[model samples]
Target: MNVVILSRQQAVERVGYSLGLDGSGLNGELSPALVGQALRRATSILAPCARYELERSVRQTLQPLGSPGDVVGPMVQDVLESLIVYRDLLEMRSTADEVWASAEVTIRPAAPSFVKREDGSIAVLGTAGDVITPIPEDLPARLVHRGALRLLVPTSAEPLAPRLQEFGLVELSEKAWLRLPRVEPAGNYVEEWHRRLREAPIGNRPEGLLICKPTRRGTLYRDRWNPAEVGETGLFVARRPQRFGANLWCLVDLQPNSTARIVDLFSTGDTLRSCDVAWQIQMALDARAGLAQAFRCRPNGDRSTIDFFSPIPSWAERRLFLVGRRQAGTGCLYSYEMATTAADGERRFLRESLWLVEQN
Candidate 1:
C-alpha cells in the first residue's frame, strides 16, 4: 500500500484541532495566526525534540477538556510535520552567561549534510540545502567535541564513518580500542571516590557494581552476569578481589579524579556492544550532573537515534546553556574506557568519546 504524506498546511490545521484550537478564527478556517500561536507555544515548551513538544502541548492544552478523541493520532502526525517545516526558524536560546547568553541558535545538520573543505573549516549547508557557511578550520576541534550536532543517523541511510574518514573527522571508532590503557586497582583513589559518591544527591547515585562472566557453550558465548547472581553479596569491597568467575570478571573501580575504570575478562564483544557500554556511562554522568533530556545512542548504529540533547532547569540553576562554547556552555566532552580479557587471557582495551550538546 502507498503511504500518504500531508502537506505543511494540512499538518498545521490537524495539529490545531488536536490542541483544542476549535478551528475557528478570523478566516473562519484554522487561521495561520492561530497555528502560529500554537507553534510558538510548543516552541516555548522546548522539549528534547520537536515531536515531544507537539504531543506535550496538545495534552497540556487539552487537559482541562479531558481526553482527546481519535483525532489525537492524526493531530500528532500533523503537528510533527509542522514542526519539521519550522525547524530552521526555531531558535534554541541559552541563558548561560558566557557565549550564547540570551542568544537564539538553530539546529544544523551534521556529517553528510556538513562537510569539510580544503581550508580545514567545515562547510555548512544553507537553508536552501547548499553549502554557504564555512566553519573555521580551528573550529572543527571546538565543534566536533563541543558543538552539538546530532550524530545518530538512520542505518538505511549511508554510514557516516566513511564520509567522516574522507575528511579525517572520524575521531572515535572501533580502532580507538587500540589506544586504551589497562585497568588496575584504584588504590588510595578509592577513598576519595567514596566521599564524592556519598556527597552526590540520592537521585544521582549509581547502582551497585555489576559483575559478568562469559561462558562458551559451543561457538557462541553467553554472559552469565545477572543481578540475581549478586544475591546477598555486598557490592562494596575494601581490598583487592580475586576472579569472580572462571572465564570473565568485571569490576568497576572509582578513582579520586572523578573517573571510573571498568575491568572485564573476555573482551571479545563487537563494536556495537562496546558502544552500548559507552552510552550507559554517558547517561550516568549526565544524570549526576543534573542535565535533562540526555541523548542516548543505541548500540547498533541506526536511524532510531535522535540528533540532539537538551538540559532542563534544575533547582539550583534556573537557566540552561543552549549553545556550544569553550568556557561555559551546555556542550560537554567526555570519554570512557574499559579493559577486557580475551579467551586466551590476553587483555584488550577500548575507549569511547561522548558529546552532550544542549538543545532547545
Candidate 2:
C-alpha cells in the first residue's frame, strides 16, 4: 500500500523548469508551480551549500562583468535546480503528519533512546524503550549525526534506515538533523520565563517566540564604504540565571514593504533606554523595498509600534539578523522585508513577531 500523493501537473511543471524552460508555460513535461513550494524548502535545506557557491559566483561575475542583473540570472537558475526535490519531500511530510494523526502508531522523538555517559550510566528518553542497554562509546557521534534511530512515518511503518539510504545519508537525513550550536539557557533565564508566563494577563501572554543564542552575528554589507559592520547586527536573546533580554536590530536598506520586522524584549535588572536598542530597529526600517517604503517605529520610553504605509506583499525578499553569544547566552534580532510584485497586482504583507519559552 503505497499511499503517496502527487499532482501530475506539478511533476510536468517541475520537469519543464528543471530543463531550463522557465517561460515555456506550464504545459510541459513537468510543473514548476506545483512543485515550487516544496522545492524551495528542500533545496533550502539540502542544497544550502549551493547558495554559497552561487554567492561566490556572483561575486566573481560582478567584478569582471560588472552587471548585477546578468549575474543574478545564473545564480537564481542554479538555486532552482538544487531545490527541485523539495516537492516530493514536502509531500512526504504532509503524508506523515496525516498518518500519525490517524494511525495506531506511537512515534518516539528520539530513537535508540539511550546513551551511556562516562560513568557508564544510561540515559533514555521517549517511547523507544531503553534501546541501547549497553551504551557505545561512539554513541555521541551517532546521536549527533544519525538522527532518530527509527521512525514510523505513515508512508511506511518501517524504521528509517532503508529510507535514509534511498534519500542519501549526507544529503537528506543527516543534514536535516544537524543542530546549530547554541548556548544553553541559564537557570536564571528559565526562572524568568516561568515568571513571565505565570504573570501573564488574562489573555496577554507573550505573542512571539524568542530564541537564545541563535547564532553568531553576521552582516550583509560587503562594501568598505558601507558604514554598517558585517557582524554588528542580528536577532538574538541574552539569558542569565534569573533574567533574559532581547536585542533586535535591522541594518541599512530600509525601504517600503520590506518582509522583515524587528522586536526586542528582555528581562533585565537595569532599566532599558530607547538609545540601547532603537538604532538597530531604525536600520531595519530604513532598508530598501523597491517602490514601497517601510513603516517607521518611534520608541516612546519602553514600548513602540511600527505603522507601515502598507503591508508587504508575499514572495518579497527579506533579510533578517540575529546575533548571540554562546558563552554568555545573549543576543539580538534583525529583519528586512523585500519588495515583491504580484502577478495579479495585489498588496504585500510581511510581518514577524517574537516571544520566549522556558525549559522544563
Best by TM-score: 1
The lDDT of model 2 is 0.26
lDDT of each: 0.30, 0.26
- Candidate 2, position 237, lDDT: 26
Best by lDDT: 1
lDDT score, candidate 1, position 349: 11
Which stretches of model 1 miss by more than 4 angstroms?
A: 1-41, 45-55, 58-193, 198-360
lDDT of 2 at 110: 25
Q: In candidate 2, how many clashes are counted?
A: 60
TM-score per model over all chains: 0.22, 0.21
Worst 10 residues of 2 by lDDT: 319-328
lDDT per residue, candidate 2, 31-138, as tens digits? 223232222323333332233343344334323322323443444443333221111111111124453232111111222232222222222222212222112333
Clashes of 1: 3
